[model samples]
Target: MRSETTPARPLGLTFRLDEVPAEGRRFEGALTEQSLGADLPGMVGDLGYRPTGPARIAGNVYRSAKTELVVDGRVTVGVGFDCVRCLADRVLAVDIREDHVLVRRKARVVEEGEESQTIDDEALEEPDVETFSGEEIDLTDLFRQDLLLALPMNPSCDDVGADDCRDLVGERAPDEPQIDPRWAPLLEMKKKMT
Candidate 1:
């Protein structure tokens, strides 16, 4: 399972920085989970989200002023995850359009007596802006960012109607309240006061 915080290396969704024409070009393809791995679903099983099908990607890349790459695209896929109510597997169909403003990464310059690294934000107000370095621009990265955003923080059968949610209707916890040993004194004090 892949950790949510660490990003896997590029899985071959790259385009040359100098190759994009001013007129812009369209790129489209279907990305299989095998290619994107845990990022798409099965690989991120630890995150409780998985892809049930291939992710379709279609987009346009254009080289703009300041040598920035702008991406406009759409992705459609099904995500499989355990429902919060019953632990039953459920699938959520996802289709979303995303636009990314990508800028080439500036080389970090460490000066004398510098205790921290401060970034220059050229497009600080632009939503969904990203940065890359070198001659290659990886679209796979864009796919990863967008898909991660699409996942619901809490998925339940009731949310998507994936199931009837009847499984938890009559379930009940043990009559005894669960308590932590460290909190016994505090809890006892409160009970005495009551």
Candidate 2:
């Protein structure tokens, strides 16, 4: 639910040019659930997960080019969701590794009648490329995006020692022929044939 068109606001996880050394830098931070803001609650509700605690992010940002940075990081968070089978709340610890290329946006001039520009094939193929046009790069959205994608689509507590799950013994009922009223005539015909 985060928007890229809106102006960037510092979430205290921003990395400015001055913070990055010529050789790059390693940064770490802990973002509490409250700091993640309202968008996160909506996202978590949609995913049927209840956040249990803060999320920790740690990573290294490398200066790939004068106006480009490569970020490699890990986000870890604890969440609680109902088991798909038993409907019992189950706690899950998720850790997601993120790698992204941040490119400084540059202004471009287009002439009249020129064809509209499109993303390059390379950029389309690589999903981690993002563009920023500012002195500071805010990683708040990136962390949220990664965490959402990393959530299990169908979380189930089926592991050993999970007592909340229902137990059903396999059994077979007696084989009995069940004929619908509409099919009774056909069954009679088949019996006559036999």
Candidate 3:
């Protein structure tokens, strides 16, 4: 009987950042027990099994006239992913400490010889890149992207198959011959000539 225990689920909280309107307002909370939705599931494709883990997200948000939301903080996340090489389910972790600025709508200003541009304005209209919901920001997509970014395109988990895998990538094995599809017509012509 194999019994596995996943980490405790964190709590979920939701609040509007804009609700507390201030030049420099700071909001912080702990995600103790939470559940990730089916859309942004776990590392494994299996829908029946849920990817459970503990995460701590702390950030300071400042709302400026020009900037709707400016968040700066570190999101520590630990997750489990399948090893590409051995196909073994392994525990992988990532810490994303990033600063993101979201503008709801750019303030229009009159300037000499300046055509009103909507560059930053466009980004403001869009959803929050780091955290979408006003209250609790789900770290599922962010966590998954970070895990894949940390992984190599082809990771070698063993030394025995390292050479073989490298050779396969370089295509230098003697047993393996490179076949050119363009020569099919030439081979047919040569057969008729013979």
Per-model TM against the reference: 0.63, 0.67, 0.44
Residue range 32-124, candidate 3, lDDT tens digits: 325433322332233212234555665555665433556665555554433333444444344666556544433558597898775564564
Q: What is the TM-score (0 to 1) of candidate 1?
A: 0.63
What order do candidates take by lDDT, descending? 1, 2, 3
lDDT of 2 by residue, 78-119 (tens): 877766555567777888888989877665555789875544
Q: List the candidates ranked by TM-score, beginning with the highest.
A: 2, 1, 3
Instruction: State the C-alpha lDDT per candidate.
Output: 0.65, 0.64, 0.42
What is the alpha-carbon lDDT of model 3 when measured against the actual structure? 0.42
- Please give the distance, in angstroms, between residue 112's alpha carbon in candidate 1 and its true position after superposition: 8.9
Model 1 clash tally, residue pairs: 4
Error of 2 at 40 (Å): 5.5
